[model samples]
Target: MSDTAREGDAEGSGVSEGASGRTDAHESGAERTAASDESSTDAREPPRLDGWPLVGNTVEFVRDPFGFYDRLESRGDAVRYSVAGDEFCTFFDPDYVEQILVAENERFRKAQILRDSAAGFAEQGLLLTEGEVWRDQRVRIQPAFTPEKIRGYADAMVTYADRLCDNLADGEVVDVGDAMSELTLKILAKSLFDVDVAGRRAVVREATAALNDRGDASGASAFLPDWVPTPKNRRFERAMSDFESMVDDLIAERRTGDESEYDDLLSILLDAEGPDGTTMSEAEVRDQMVTFLFAGHETTSLALTYAWHLLGRNPDELERLRAELDAELGDRRATMADLPDLPYTDRVLKETLRLYPPAYVIFREPTEDVRVGPYHVREGTNLTLPVFEIHRDDRFYDDPDEFRPDRWRDDFESELPDYAYFPFGGGPRHCIGMRFATAELRLVLATMARELAFEPTYDGDPDLTMAATLRPENPLEMRVERR
Candidate 1:
């Protein structure tokens, strides 16, 4: 079960979530006033959340990350510790998360763990790069995900969802998680690659799952070198080899085929100019395609999985959601234009993300010394910002653990800290696929809810496991009833 303990409350301290400038020394000093006695710096070191010797917090964290981070919040705003011989100071404050991700972004880079974890598969993709390289790649890729372009895929999303649902019977039990996975992948492949992956869906799913599981396992073994061929590493290598081969075949086929009718993301990426004004190389294009394939579908599927599970647990909320969908899109499929009218559906997605953000935690490393709250973190020190913990912090949320989409019905975005609910992350590195994912989620939910009402058979919240994204420990099995 998820822990709901409130060990300490250091409210009204730290930089204001909306503060425009880097946190001033005065503010940092003021925030220190609320730090626990253990955090006081007479000893000249930050408060350490000590764990088992040598291996440190690695084992415990891998075993129960949610509970470990939940308990750490009570320790202090900045809690220092060693995991796998590497020192880290986790910042549970939104102000700190914003500083690292935005205002002082230039002073930090993507965490080594994140880069290493995705390196072999997503080598030099936008997600792992920093500095001018990332800037150029972002510029080149930005056009493919604009509002207008994403809207163009609406019909494809609805069409694919309908087709997927056609395979379901009104009274049969289905693995909702697996179903969503296939549906989202099909939609992504058709809309972005302009290809149908229905025949290869199982291969793509299996490969992605293996990669994610291996990534999570590698992350847990914090100090292990990437070159080491552990069992999980070997599995990842095999999966990557298969995934790359498939992606290569797709790219080669697209290259040799006629381009006059091509208007998909792959075509745009191929035609995009690099910083030097030359066309991107085939290798670069392949890297980007692989990155998008994994990102564009994986987390979105997980979000849908969590949405159904959350709705099933809260029938009243589910009813309200269904009412909105029924009234706004009665007996009709949802289009991109209708998304604005489905306020309750939007709120439910926001609430589901708040409770179970797919990209739940982010890791970073400072390029220079940084002062966050009362602590002085040295340059190159690893820092972790747990969005999962931050979202549930009582200072920013009421009854933070409860499911309440109603909170978003109000102008909660303006009322709360900007960083409080960053499901897509923040700053320049914010997910480029944000617009596409939102439109896809809203449209899929509208279509699915309009056609069928799901009744989850499980008794409690779906068990969570740490993967490339947070996923259910088991397939989200539910009884599907056509409406």
Candidate 2:
């Protein structure tokens, strides 16, 4: 999917060139606004297509994101554009993305639209909060993702994979995406709270389906305010509430009743105490549990689903993966101990992450004035770092448009810049459950490789649709064959 990076610099990170993107000046987020202005002011602005009145590329961007982002990066690392009254300068450069994530944490923050859209969801988890609120949540929940704990979940992951394998015969057509979603949701749900949800599938499915449906563009909350009285908004609230309630009840059961009743992820979270021996409040605990259940499930499920799609379409890669797994762990489920030994399999996952990163667009607002490249970014300005674009940029990769897992060789480790390959972001604000997600993905992939082989029945051109995260737009049909 990417070319071997020439140097060890983290991909899409460090040291910017000159002017390509600019933002409206704001006074509050002052420090966010850096690097000598001389280089920026002299550099010519990048080319941009005109949009109606003030809404530049908003409609077109929403309609065709890949095309929208590709056009911006066609000329240089960064591109300038607008969305109605909001002026945005997107950074596809690795250095720029790197700086935003690692170098300038406080300079940039999550955008207002997301902040408000998820405001109602704030009490539901850690992802929606910023600053101290986010830090506090992270403190209490971090222990659940420790290497030792993630290792424990590997057995459960394999068990779920076995259950998934049992559901589909060797040569039956099935939607791999749907299957992976269910399997991942079940594993994540149980891993977080040791509860049997054989009866609760409908409840979980309904809530997840609603979150998935939020991708709709019609009166979309992305465009409309959350307070709007639209049916979609109401539905969103209803579904989210149902989802949150399910998690809240589970937390209550564990805290008050026999704590040993379950050994799931939620239980781990409940039993965890921060460095200061602080425990999460009941609301915070519920929020983090819900957060892990959803965050830990949906995105990776999407990634693995796409990986299956990619492999099903590309027989060569598929064979290579199976061969690797067979050679590495024949007839055995992938244990946490085997993770490091299967570098090639891990590389394949990394490549998939690069090509189809779960969290494609991580948007943040400038809490302080910051300098991105040569331009000074004012406070209140929206900053969108498109990993989807950065991953495909030809500057760092040899063949930017093609898919090739082999490109992630040992040689590129020191060569790629820090932020260039951020499927799971960077800095203190990165995805907290990264280690856990990695272990979970490896377990599922390895298990499926061992127990089953799913090939796309008819090649389906799965479209990338964004809703909270990117997912396969259409049903991904596959022919499942047992190994």
Off by over 4 Å in 1: 1-45, 217-223
Q: CA lDDT, every prediction?
A: 0.75, 0.68
Backbone clash count, each prediction separately: 0, 43
TM-score of 2: 0.86
Angstrom error of the Cα, residue 481, model 1: value is 1.9
Residue ranges of candidate 2 with Cα displaced over 4 Å: 1-49, 215-221, 260-278
lDDT score for candidate 1 against the true structure: 0.75
lDDT per residue (tens digit) for residues 1-483 in model 2: 122221112222111200111111111112333442334445444345567775667887776767777777775666667764576777777666656665555556788756655656645477887766666556666556666677788888989987787778878898887788788888877676777666776666676666656544322356666778677678878977887788777766666888876655576567766657876667777777666767778888888988887777777887888888889887777788887788777887888888898888888877766567655666676678888877877767889766788888867744765467778765556666666677788888888876777787765557767767777777888898776
Output the number of the TM-score-best candidate. 1
lDDT string, candidate 1, 1-483, tens digits: 000111011111112321222234224433542442233343344688878878788887777777778778889888887767777778887767766665655668888767766758777677777888777787778767766788889998999888877777888998998889989998899889998887877668877887677766325542466678887677777887887788898988898989767887898788877768887777778788888888999989988888888887888998898898888877888898888788888888988888998888888997766565556777677788887888888998899989999988566765776467777765567677777788888888888876776789888887787777888878889998786
